[model samples]
Target chain A: MKSLDIWNRTYSRAFLDDLPHRWQRRAFLRATVKTATVIALAPLVSSLPGCSDQRSTSPPLSQAPWPTLAAVQEILLPHDAFGPGAADIRATPYLHALLQTSDFDPEERQFILDGAHRLDDICQEQHQRAFLMLDPALRDPLLRDLAESRVGDRWLGALLTYILEAMLGDPVYGGNPNGIGWRWLEHTPGFPRPSKGLFHA
Target chain B: MTDHYDVCIIGSGAGGGPVALTLAQAGYRVLVLEKGPWLKTSDYFKDEIACCRRSTYTPNLRDERHVIEEREGKNWKAQSTYDSGWDFWNGNVVGGSTNFMSGFFFRLKPQDFQLRSEFGPIKNANVADWPISYSQLEPYYTQVETEVGISGRVVAHPFAEPRSTAEFPYPPTAEHLLSRVFDHACEQLKLHAIPTPRAVLSRPVDERRACEYAGYCGSYGCATGAKGSARVALLDRAIKTGQCEIRPHAQVQRLISDDSGRVTAAEYVDTVNNIQRVRAKIFVVACQAVETARLLLLSTGPKHPQGLGNRYQQVGKNLIFSAGGSGRGEFEYADFSTDQAQALKQIGPFVNRSLQEWYFINEKQLGGKRKGGTIDFLLRHPNPISRAVGLRRDDNDELIWGQALKQRLKNEFTRAQYLDYEVFCDWLPTDDCFVSLDSAVKDKWGKPVAKIRLNSHPQDVIIGTYLSNQAKTVLTAMGAKNISGSASTSPPQNLMAGGCRFGTDPKSSVLDSDCRMHNATNLFVTDGSFMPTGGSVPFTWTIYANAFRVAEIIKHQL
Candidate 1:
């Protein structure tokens, strides 16, 4: 059931966009399931943090196969007053390293790579500009559409997973720089911290 | 050590480790064939995703595949372990899955030993009495504790089986701040919350180090040799004796026996995929229940066509897995008026609290008191990355991306500390739940893979629901604001047992009381495979203890 829940919310959620009627049904179902589980708990998060607190910004990724992804990373988890977002943490490097070194599926890697290229085309056709050059209000809705559309769902879904890894994984990797992510979350990491001694070595 | 051994052990976890140690001490040369790699202590790390995601200590399923078929009606449908569901969690490394276990040890009560006699029979379930009693195994449990090392206080538990020893070898590790809250909650509810005895060393024992309270302890291997993993606790010591040889990467495919039906040699594909046969005077099959049964079902020969000990066709019958249901209760700092909320530090690893009062419940709603199970309350694993995945959905039920996703992550991580509770109930062995060789699927070696058929008995769902409800009550008492739990129809894959059951009746059971095959004389199965009915508890301690007892019996034969 954990697997089904994860599959539905994680993978299937990306494809629900094309069918707005079916999407509403799924969203209602998701809400009903969640409400049943958390009814006794505190109400859902009231409002998100303010979206503009950019203390540190990574240089635009030049070497990347899809350079506009640097901007997409910001769009996905942009700088908020609470703390650093994906770009500030340089999530792309960590995600790239993870995809390269870890036991990543080749198919997933290809999907993400293809998705990056496809997303640019989608944005250009829809908004008459590349994803990176689009305005923030215009930029956000297009990305949300990509998440819903089947064309970019799997790729965007996987991208979100890797981005989360960057934000919360050990700072030893390039992401979560200076323990910024941990500090933001106020998460006290478990002891006997993992070292490079056994990891990639 | 000679090329050939007095005994060849097929696994390296709780079952095979003790036998290797004891037989080596008795001056017999022993060979241990572990299919997985020898991940040395130097390989131990606290990287959760690397260890979990990389299949670091488990089977890389693309090559080592299993066609897990769930019951869909009259016919069975093979579920995708990759895209859809789970594969059977076989700890594929040298120490086996024991290295990754949470180490919650609870002795099986006497009633568990004689479940058929005690509780009678349930409809369609294969509950049976064990050939050996708890008294027969008590001395060895003490031996296992003293030798292997265990920590935690043993207060009077209403459901705790009688013990010969006064207390555990080591006192409980320093309590987490949540311990006090849990205890207080249980006190108000009038449920017994005793210390959860663990197979972890609280203090330094012999050559092994003590618990460093490494918060990354549960799923990850111990960087410090505090948790009593088979490698550090047994095989490491067995290697020192110079009589035991651990041959990693030797995948045993077939067990060859003579016309008289006694085992002769084991043919295995070595690291470079060479068919290497090693002869031993005796052989012990302890590669867990599923694989042990798989090995037996795979080794088909002229003498025993149904596979090694399947003359009675009971090689893989009455499979049991622990029925599991869990709930997480989130406690934000502001939820409590008491200073206990502020003091709830997230450092110490073990919640170390369990309520066994419901282990054998007699509620009238069930018509009578039925055999229930154990519940362990735990602090959620401290890793932040996996927790971040919890933010995928928003209250509106729409997928959260962009700024909304960012803020949801912030709210979850900074705002709350959670107590996770898991209830382990009896997975009543019904004929529907068993293992067979998958005709369609094959592994990397082109051998037919094990086909696991799982349709859990309705009783499991009933017992799981009851325990989960009880867990909610305890959480409610603890002042948790958001608490939600649901009973699971699925079984905990890791806690599998009873595929190769032991009994006097040749018609119904696979192995005999001593875990020896009824048809094959020289073969012995010392894993959880020998269990007729796994009690409502973690099977590791019992598997270890029973293996120790069986080792002594095998000792007399040698």
Candidate 2:
């Protein structure tokens, strides 16, 4: 199936299912999700080649963005000779948790999801595969090319911002587990850290 | 209707704390209406995410925002704080911005009270002598040292204001090893390195504990109630008397007044969005400078049509912020021995040193007899997230990811300690910089929000640059590498005052010397709003002292 068709069908069903019963009754909210999805994906859909007849094996809309984002984060702060990278610091999970928050800006959440889709499209255009299917060496060059564009640069910067948060933020926020990032950097955290109850309270 | 209060104070920061405490102690029922939540010391911690990244202690910009108008070339551009992400809201908790202050306290020198007399006026600056002299507020400053808990060892410097007390109520908080180096550098340069006084407690004072030296003083609420915020030092004590009621999340909409031009009641929106009214013999507005002026302008009464105390259009005419720049120098570990490097890396303790050598610039090179400023030296804050975020871009402003970024982070983390200097100077009051209500933009309550026009006086930069250059010399003397500093036109949002300035002439000023509204006799503005000319230092100490001074005046009136 085409990317837009898959996104429309998968996202609408998945998002509606996630909403509370009270929220489900709000027609404007459902309309907003559908409208947002179409607006966010229109450019990517137009850029992609015809692949509607291809077997649709993409993950559900909710889970589709994470693997690409995680791949991008690993390339951004790869686990090479350096001590701890994005994966080691649990950046992707932290980002996922942040996006799930009620207080998190919805526009920013959509931007992150849209940016992931855009990255996949670029990967397919440059090399005939999804971002997750790319060779490890090819990922960095693709991200560098993405960084050349204004939106891509901002998206990467946003991801880096979250990665830094994961690396340095309190472990209670789900990143820097066991203070591994802190220990590596020789940073001494102040006392009286927030309890789990006060995580963004 | 609620029980009648002798006084209704509409803020709980440094401005309102003393009035509430003093009135309640004198057997009067005082009600304090604070716009934000009442977060105790137990609710505070040193979480970087909460303190720096999120608007935990302040209002969300989307709900309550300001319209900041800045000059872009010859034209002015207005942008909402929500769009710019430039947070104008300081600490909105019960204690206000004082909760997050670094507690670097300084008293206004005697000359500051007579700025117009001492230093002749600059071209476009509205320099005016204070209506009240320093002598009138001296005793109160001394009182704040004991009651509000200032900690420092007094040393005679050329520019040290005459203190009523020989020494601070509490001895200075523990100092870092860098202080010694700073002192030595100052000695070599023939400069008087005064031990910077802090509002933080050095030892246990009643229920409050001493400083924990958490290296996260600025921008973070005090976890130990040692920073001497208004809530901990004053309001908490007032509650013990059973005469003071602190109603948090009670955002006052306006002061309701009678035709006789006396404030009869304060109308506020409660936490549940219910409109509540309470009668009081006297009403005090101490909501800092910008919001204080906004409150008065919003309160339109029959007797005072334009707004209470705004008959002459002087309610928000002279908004001032501290105009200065900050610089940092790195102390590399490789340059020092292991012991020295270890001492350099030591955290928590403060670099309690300041230089007021240029407080009065008599140099002929710049200009003869110009007012200068204060230079405070300290350690760079240890917020690792902020530090890491700053390093995301390379010298060319390109994203540096993967191995390059990781190595950069590692090097920055382990390499050297950074010492910083902050230059605080007068943001000269002018016709251009003032607070007014935005015509279109409304707050979450559907009331017009504060619109601030920021235009700094050119001479402020000249003085700030002079002071910053002097600071760089001391840093160079301390053997710091890559020393760079400059003066900026950007205003420090935290150190603000002088919207509703007090003066003798009713036509030119909002309040009289007693801080009571000139036309509306029963209404008083006890915050930094009463400052006609804010001195070249932090305003908290002055605000605390003046509030204590005003409280005594209110006591006699009652």
Q: Which runs in model 2 stand beyond 4 Å of their true positions? A: A1-62, A199-201
Tens-digit lDDT track for model 2 on B243-278? Answer: 999998899999998889999999999867999999
Q: What would the per-residue lDDT of candidate 1 be over residues A1-201, giving only the tens digit for each residue?
A: 222233335434423332222111111100011222223111111111221223223332364454666677777787877578777776776665544532345545555665666666666677767666778788777767665544455445556666777777666555676667777877766555555433323
Error of 1 at B198 (Å): 0.6
Chain B TM-score (model 2 vs. true structure): 0.99
Q: Which candidate gets the maximum TM-score versus the true structure?
A: 2
| Colliding residue pairs in candidate 2 | none
Candidate 1 is scored at a TM of 0.90
Against the native complex, each candidate's DockQ, computed on alpha carbons, is 0.20, 0.24
Mark the regions of model 1 whose C-alpha exceeds 4 Å error after superposition. Answer: A1-64, A199-201, B336-342, B395-397
Best candidate per DockQ, number?
Answer: 2
TM-score of chain A of 1: 0.65
The lDDT values for all models are 0.75, 0.84
Per-residue CA lDDT of model 1 for B194-301, tens digit only, reads: 899888888987778888776777778877777888888999988999999999888899899888888989988887888899999889998888888889999987
lDDT of 2 at B95: 86
Candidate 1 iRMSD, 1 decimal: 11.0
